[model samples]
Target: MDIDVFAATHAQEWKRLDELVRRRRSLAGEEVDELVDLYQRVSTHLSVVRSAGQDPNLVARLSALVARARSAVTGAHSSSWSEVSGFFTRTFPGTLYRLRWWWIGASAGTLLVAFLAGAWVVLDPEVLNAMQTPEAMRQYVEHDFANYYAENPGTSFSAQVWTNNAWVAAQAIVFGVFLALPTIAVLAMNGAGIGSSAGMMIVHGRGEEFFSLILPHGFLELTAVFVAGGVGLKLGWTIIEPGDRPRLRALGEEARAAMAVALGLVVVLFVSGLVEGLVTGNMVRGRIATPVGLGIGFFVEVLFLAYVYTVGKRAYRKGETGDIRNTPEAVPVAG
Candidate 1:
């Protein structure tokens, strides 16, 4: 096909399509129909021009014209406050509810590991000694551990904690592609760290103090971590078992859902960070009573659980999969 001849033949339609798109907002009913018709014809012209491998300039012009015309025909999407509200009320909770089993198991398994690790440390003097010198252990149990929360200013500390925890959560979700080994490692390391700390405190008779400080934030913070780990494992498992969908397609779907969890966790971790830096820190500093702090943290944790079960369950029931709404179906590929 002669590029010049093709351009001359379709030049009029392209010009008309451009005009229609520019005046799309004020188009009359007949003009709208005409715009749609020209949009299709120009799209075909673009395909033909590209396939012919002639006149790159002409191809570029047609591509841009087609894009504008298509947008005019289909309309454009814009973000709104409703989208933000829907994310929290429906998407986040629904995702949490849908993946409830995965995260719950993660929580149970992590807690068990923590328990076993603490028990081991308490039961074995040699193991405990190997972990730290007796003096250092005493220092940590008596002062260092408690001082951690109050050492930094509350606002900065909260920001620091939020960033650190968010990074951990992101790692768990992103690294899940490696068969979840990294996610498991992350969870195990977290559990062992908590358990060892608890063991050290319990051995020194500060177990009550430990719980008072840790539980005030650990309840929610740890849950967020568990959610990330569970979602990561689910992602890894998707690679192993994609169900009825093609492996790549299934992975794509789950990966998108994992991203939603990742984003939701940022907010979750932020709240936990505030509790840790403000409530727990104040309790350590004697500004707030230990019992009140504990109650506040517990309440927050309970609130999150309630949100998941209520909003999340409702959204899931309504067919919310936590994935982006209206995701285009994957095109079939030949093997």
Candidate 2:
């Protein structure tokens, strides 16, 4: 093959491809077809130039031109529903499993703080006095606590709880971007609320009432919050200590994981909210319904943990990071 002759022959086609690609607007149907055709020809021309020992610079230029033209012809690819399906089935759970340790630690810390706070309030009269006046505390324990469940219709109450809990989870996930202090604060605040409420109920001799009202939904609701806090704390830790990866890269990777956990928790919180409203609100047979709802929540949490350990671990081992199908694009994995 005569290199110079071949170059001269294809130079006009190459120039035409450059012009078509540089055009910034939509191409006509004919032009689009031309783009694909020219792309194919240019690809072949580059191959020939490389094989025939053409000028290195010219071959390189043609190679770059072909790549651009091919991309132009193909346009950007869109994600399919199958990718979304794969996300929930593989990536989401897998990511959860990988970061399970981070969240477990978060949960342990928060629970410890909560239990201590509750015990302090219950044992020391001064601690309860610091929180509220005796009259106010008595009012809350005797009436406000129980009335809270029945003040609104069950459906509306469920929606209210769901949205509020979702907002808290969202805050935890987003605030984690700032070195995790906000997330820790939110967890401590939530834990304190639960502890104080339970301690107050027990002190007022309404322990059974509190158990029936809280146990039905508290387990799942609190578990979801714990998971959110755990993921958020992990995000913050990633930023502070990205290990071998660049700090920004690690933060970005963990940020995506945090966001996924935030979104997944919305559904979990909603289910818990429904249990709270329906079981706790139903004065009729609520005692029977409460334990049943508690069992349901516990079952769900166990299933989720089991899934993460089994399915999620397998997926993580296979290199799924729960970052969606951003493959063929260099994704920065933190660890």
Candidate 3:
């Protein structure tokens, strides 16, 4: 390639990159730092080319510089777009590949924690029955169910729901920063509660009724908790595996991503709550039309998780390249 032609092409790209760096949030300070560093090098090459007055070696060097600059610009643009998309879509897992081992490990660890905790409760029928005392179940079904809606008639509306969701989301997000201890605690408490309740019901020979009452909303509710716990686990591992970077820096980066996930989970919990409150109320399967409704809800959750798995991985890679620093207490594991 002609050095002059190559330089001209890349000069346009360099200028465009400058414009993009200013406009795009993903290409923040650090990315711009790299671009400026390359720009300085390019400028020096340009100066050499000018002084050399068309020497073949100078032209060749200039061409090499142009290629490098062009490649950098291309990489920057691709990375920035990837980060931007991931941010909008809330895709973190794939973006932080360096931290992948941590994410997966923490997630799996949290779930195991939950399962183990639940196992203890399940093994102890007495503990299971204690939490779900007849009076407690009655109160939950009658007063608590009605009182919750009385406390928030506006929850059915979008804005109010989002506002309430944002508040809980913030709690989950901020609380996510501490990571391991908090998440482990949440998983244990919730998991144990479920397991004990199940064991108790089975012991009391109310197992069939319990399954029927729980199967509809419990599935969604439990899944939400597991997802939230997974976010917390990811955040915890950020503390453990902050990479070669400073621990604080790695924590900040992973925290942002975890916060986004936790926020999303809060929204999911609201939907699950609504279903439990409204649909679960008519415990009579026939009245609530359990089969079709539960089927749809189950399908939606499955599809949603699948989408998260695919899109999140792709977006995470993009975010890491673009550098976007983006949690949860669980009440239960997903059924």
* Winning model by TM-score: 1
lDDT of 3 by residue, 6-82 (tens): 56756665565455445444677776677766655555555444333344344344444554455555564346778
Better of 2 and 3 by lDDT: 2
Candidate 2 per-residue lDDT, tens place, 47-109, comes to 565544435456557767876676676776336887666767777788888888877887898
Error of 3 at 309 (Å): 2.5
- Candidate 2 shows a clash count of 0
Using lDDT as the yardstick, the better of models 1 and 2 is 1
The regions of model 3 sitting more than 4 angstroms off are 1-173, 282-286, 317-335
Task: Name the candidate that leads on lDDT.
Answer: 1
lDDT of each: 0.86, 0.77, 0.53
Each model's TM-score?
0.80, 0.74, 0.54
Q: Of the pair 1 and 2, which is ahead by TM-score?
A: 1
Give the deviation of candidate 2 from the true structure as CA RMSD. Answer: 10.2
Candidates sorted by TM-score, best first: 1, 2, 3
Q: Residue 168 in model 1: shift from native, Å? A: 0.9
The TM-score of predicted model 2 comes to: 0.74
CA shift of 70, model 3, Å: 20
Positional deviation of residue 55's Cα in model 1 after best superposition, in angstroms: 30
Model 3's alpha-carbon lDDT is 0.53
Better of 1 and 3 by TM-score: 1
Ranking by lDDT: 1, 2, 3
